[model samples]
Target: MCLAVPGKIISIHDDGSLMKMGQVRFGGIVKEVNLAYVPSVQVGEYVIVHVGFAISILNEEEAQKVFSYLQEIADEGGQ
Candidate 1:
């Protein structure tokens, strides 16, 4: 199985063009992700990321809820 987590889009390339990269915060850690699919994603938005790419966008609250639930599951050591 594969897991793609929700992360906050901290910043998109100021150029706002194709071949753009962005910063995404997940589990309180930030990482660079490719935004080639959604080249228009803006800062402060959230996206679901997998394998170094942002696949889709989601709201901040919803992303946080997912994160919280995942944290709970991790704390439980899996089911």
Candidate 2:
């Protein structure tokens, strides 16, 4: 089962090209994600990432809801 996680963009790297990259923070883990698909994304914005790519931008409220659901699943799996 594939999952797209919600995370906040911490930093971006664009070298005047179509290929843009950014560091996205998921909880305490940070990973580099491709930002070319989200041209209007800015720092501190929430994005849904899948397979190292930011597929879409989401509002903070939606992001938190998804996070909470994921946390619930994690907690259930631990028991």
Best by TM-score: 2
- Worst window of 10 by summed lDDT in candidate 1: 58-67
Would you list the C-alpha lDDT of every candidate in the order shown?
0.85, 0.92
Q: Summarize candidate 1's per-residue lDDT along 16-79 as a digit string, tens digits.
A: 5666899999987999999988766888888999999999988657647865996898989975
* Cα lDDT of model 2 by residue, 1-79, tens digit: 4799999999999986978999999999999999999999999999999999999999767647865997899999999
TM-score of each: 0.66, 0.72
Candidate 1 lDDT (Cα, whole model)? 0.85
In the order shown, what is each candidate's alpha-carbon RMSD?
8.1, 8.3
Candidate 2 regions off by >4 Å?
61-79
Off by over 4 Å in 1: 14-18, 59-79
